[model samples]
Target: MNALMLAVALATHATPVSLEDARARSRDNVQALTAALQASSAEQDVRASRSSLLPQVRFSAGASLNYIGPQRSYNVVPVEGGGFQQLQIDTPEVRYPFFNLGVTVSQLLYDRAVWARLEQSGAQLEALRGEATEQQDTSELEGINRFYSLFRTQATIQVLEANVRRSEQQLERARALFQAGRVGKAEELSALVNLGNDRIAVVSRQSQLATDQARLSTWLAMPGAEAVEAVDPGVLTQAPAPAPSLEQALQEARTRRPLLVALRQRLRVAELQESIANAGYLPRFSLDAGYQRTGPEPSVFFGQPARQNRVNGGLSISWDLFNGFSTQAQARRAEYQSRVAELNLQQSERELEGSVRQSLVALQAQIVSAELAEANRKAAADALVLAEERFNAGVSSTLEVRDAQLKLTQAELTLLENRINVEIARFTLMRAMGTLAPGEAK
Candidate 1:
């Protein structure tokens, strides 16, 4: 039996993970990965846009065959004395094969629109980078929340199991008293009922622990079939640090928040779009040069006498004199979009401020609640000891002891919950302030 119990313990044991470790393992989170991919794509777009500013070189080669149908020609032959004789001649089919190779290079001398597009692409890249950071922050926060949740459930289950053991002890005591004729069978039955209820509560708590463990494991990208255990960071015994002033928090959020930075970048992009749209009002200039070789044969080998070589260079200018008022419409649309981006930025700022304030309040409240719960737990423990003593001395009934045990269980669970909440609230405030990072508390 001892060996069987040891085997069960070993089988059920889970490896403990910390919040930081869990977050490190969560790099493959879908949202974060998606954001990273988008950022990479935007980086490619920036490269493409910048390439447009450089000279473009192209090489082309082609071979073609031409054929014409048989032709009839009339020739007038001068006779010996006068132009009186006409002669008919037949011509063979005309067929030829031609080959050409060319190299061309073009450079844009002036185009405000192309420059604006490059600037826009650069701004877009910055925006995507900010979004990627925001996604990472979000994923880290989620991992922290799950980690604490699992910790809380595990602690609660411990308390529940202790309560079940206390109930069992109370039932045994009641049976002893009834056999000694010091208490009635009713008291024993009540104790038995309490034990059953406590056991039921334990079962429920264990189920909850299982569920929370699964959730945390999934968030950490661990195998779904494996169990994950959380190690208590002992926040319950330590005092929470005071929260920063609301003004300071708001400043930090504005300065460091990834989403806000992204919005600002997007606003720049929109402004650049407006410039690009208006660039159409000006003319564009470019220089192009080309070299070509043409021959009747498909070979360009060293200086074939039949090959023809040509070189050309030119400056080109394009001006859109009219485009059915499309440029005007585009400029107007860009302006509206710029306005929209500004409004979105402002709204996000307001929302972020609100979140920071709310998190601060919650953190303060949880800290105070944790303090009170600690005191309550201590008092309940003393009460339980006294009740047990009175029951053993025959001065109090088993009911009093059971009630004390229940109160102590509640107190312990409450303290555990409040401590977990304090930690979570602290991290939440950090997230809202945009300072959340792996393994580090703001």
Candidate 2:
């Protein structure tokens, strides 16, 4: 309730707020920092993957029961007294218990395309980092835009309310004149109708202002938030130097823009994938070691007997003989993907160039528009004063006075909106060139 009351109060006494302040408040938001964290985590994954190139060792120790059904041959050649002529018969299988221990070591020796994949992983990691950075910037830019929009709405609503008051005062004055037999009754009725219409406008604008405030709250993720206060959105002015040149903007984008960096990194990853695929046919080498021990105890060899340990170690190599051209096909596919990535990169470059140039052009136009709005607002103010003076002296009709008032009101609102639009336009240019400033994160 207190916040709402404060918001209502701001409707009447809003103060000037600088663009820098709004951006700073938005940056302090927590959401922005969360995005940065997500990016850092993704980069960590890439680092882990890259570390796979290092050698790895594993130790295995376990015990298992092994048994075959016991088997016996009736006609066995005995060393002492053998009966070769005896009928031969075989019993069931044999059973044994054994324990094994081994250690395994594997190293990523050079082969087809593993390096390429590692490089690709690095690129992917970089891309994700860039994505996070871009999101942070984009989120803040949106907040700034909403801030300005909210300010404009608040200002316009105030102007409309003022119009309503002015109309009411005029109606009162016209009624007095009519009662004195100085003006026709029709004039008073016209004033009454105008006042009603102005009041209606005030209500409509206030409704719009509420809607804008709700949207701003949602964007800023304000917790249990109240309606937005009307910010002053201070003077409408252009950056001192207007927009930077196209070349400079593009250069900045190349170095500073996250999306651009991400795209470039993705392309590099694709190239690495191509390399990895081509290397798929290469041979791979690995080392292994283990130990084995066997006891002469046939009783021990049976499932009920005790077991012994074993250790063994060896080096092994496997070279693929053929895969029916599968590897070749995969390499070709990777090559095609690499080409596509390169094309996309080129497209990004061209689009960025146009975007930067277009923003610069719009910024220049707003400068002119802002100056014109200022001059028009001043002229309208002067016109209203003169018309009011003439009507008081009985040298003008009510129609002239009303028209002058309407024109002046329109001019004032126009000037305020124009100021906001110009500010938004400057920020738009900043965003286009990937130069939005940092703000507080919640």
Candidate 3:
């Protein structure tokens, strides 16, 4: 099948795509990219949360102009050697400019909520990473299924075409025998019918191939008219490696499956959220320091000696005290969420165990089927040869030979199909066990 795909690719001068290429292309899959982006965003959230534990510095500057109206002033002026006299004066209008520049620094001395949030964010990031990996695996599997399905259809078409050619040859022989009076009209008619059926089968197989190719093009993100050829991985003909016992597979899945790992991380994240919620009942403390300069001009920040300059530092604590029972309600909700996460993890484990068992059984059954199919194909080939010899020697009828030919074709197709099925089963079992290679498409 792989050879056929490569041949088609070479004949058409189209770039041949292998399973590895499909897996690589899966990196650009939309769902995987979205998960990766989510992971990246979560990482930023973690950084932002952790930043609360570090000192933060901010610098600010402002300038304002104030206009003042004329003011009346009262004063007592003293005479040279007499009593003081009262006087009145009107002051001119004036404009005043104010400017200030300051830098403020704050550090989180102790805040349980911020610390809990940081921990939660880290766990969420890990969960998103796992999700991204899952999406990648899913995309790869989708591409692989499409590729192999197309391969299967193409192979079937090849078989049907060969069958049609064989039937045509048999029909010609039947017609010649009929004219020579060695066979009757019925035999020739039967041969014609067989040839027509084989042609129909070829048409059906071709249609199936076209459909599979169209689906594969969607996975490859190519134009509808683009040709895609899959590399034959030779998995159908190769003997698979020994699989582990059911118990071993389950154990491996428990430790290695990305979904399980991600779920565990989510559980931890939920626990951290609960902690964060409970933290609302506790007091938060921090340290703050600032330096400031103020004057009538922007230059007062640096050059004006008359500018007021000051530095201040302080420690602060905030206790929520009460918020109309909202804090208590949040704590309860978080605890409930934690419980739900635990339950979900348990459910996932149960489902995963079932899947592993089912896949193992299916793989074992398909292996047996492949062995039987091979034996059947050999028997059918022998039968066809014997029947053809009998017909040539005039010891048996053409109907017997035609039946044997049909049986041989069916047996060949069955063997090939079963071989592919076994390969698919092997892949499924590996996926269930969480042991599939990173680069290999499912």
Candidate 4:
């Protein structure tokens, strides 16, 4: 109740919104924003992987204190030619501080594994982007659905309110007739009961409208105190175009569907992973070089700067040869995953075909339903007018007029619902074909 009051207060000063505005508001939606952020993170992964293919350089420096113990030696020279004198020598203890600095650079001369990993990262990034697009599309479609629902519910509430007013008028007329002895009390009572029923229907419809508005608020990312008033949008009255052939739709879905594209990229990533694992069986070559200075203090090699100054470089090869069959197992697992990706891609394609077909069929059915509902509404309106006239002429009772009004109210509501359904179905078809987006249909 509090939320409803707050919404009503906020809505009082708000302008009505259209379907396009609803779709645009979805750009700020939490789901869409989160997906976009994830895509950006994936792009960074691509950059990091590319960096691995470049040369690496690092610097190191260290300092330490050392202690040296005394050294003692004793020697006897073969008895010193039969007059051997034993000689003993002892060296004093010493301590020194040592510091050194070095820089090392390494570059990959040949490594198929690193190259494959770079490719795999690129494929994974592509898949992430596709998934992000799918999230965006899904969020937009949900917003559209909620907007239409709120609009339809609001319209129904208006119809119920109008019905209640008509019932009240009929009750007044019945009361006048009973007082004049032209009608009995039962007729007036029946009219009063109907007015009560219409009032109850109005209350029920108002509750439903409130619920629908709350749901739309969430999709629009509005605060609880803010309410959205979705106007007619004008799309409800527009007729849908003819659906494309089934085979054409299937082809388009296979090519355009985000999930299918993402899965295909995943399959490529898995294949690259397999290549990377197999690369372990081959020798890797690299070039590494370093410069070092050793002295009493930290210094690079300059003239008379250090006791030892050295520049070293080497070209090295590494071969795992055998490592407990780990490489073989990894390759096997990647192969299995590759198969899984392939199956996933195929499954998405099949489902897309089915979804597209089903939506098209449903769209046609809704179009027909809307036409029939419009016709029914017109017929009910004519009957209501004729029954009202007959009652006024004393040729019919209030019951006939009441039944006609009820039928007309129900028919009007049905027409509104059917129109909204047709629009929803058309959008659903577009979504299934991977073409649903803001401003596209409009």
TM-scores, all candidates, are: 0.90, 0.81, 0.88, 0.87
Q: By summed lDDT, which 10 consecutive residues of candidate 3 come out lowest?
A: 2-11
Model 2 over residues 1-442: C-alpha lDDT tens digits? 3434544654553333445655765655566677778767877776777766777777765566677775756664545475455557877776655554456666766655556666777788787777766776777787788787777877777777777777777778778888887778887888888887776676666666667666666666663235666456446443334556777877776666667888888899888887887776778776665554455444554444346555566677787779899889988998899899999988988887787788778877777777787788789879878876786666766677789789878988888876676667777777766778543111
Question: Highest lDDT: which candidate?
Answer: 1
TM-score of 2: 0.81
Ranking by TM-score: 1, 3, 4, 2
Off by over 4 Å in 3: 1-15, 71-91, 175-181, 240-242, 297-302, 438-442
lDDT of 4 by residue, 184-228 (tens): 899899999999888777666666766777788878888745566
Q: Give RMSD to native, each candidate.
A: 3.6, 5.4, 4.6, 3.8
What lDDT does the true structure give each of the candidates? 0.86, 0.70, 0.80, 0.82
Across 252-276, the per-residue lDDT of candidate 3 in tens digits comes to 7787677777898999999998999
Evaluated against the true structure, the overall lDDT of model 3 is: 0.80
Checking candidate 4 for backbone clashes, the offending pairs are 79-84
- The model with the greater lDDT, 2 or 4, is 4
Please report the candidate that would top TM-score against the real structure: 1
Worst 10 residues of 4 by lDDT: 297-306
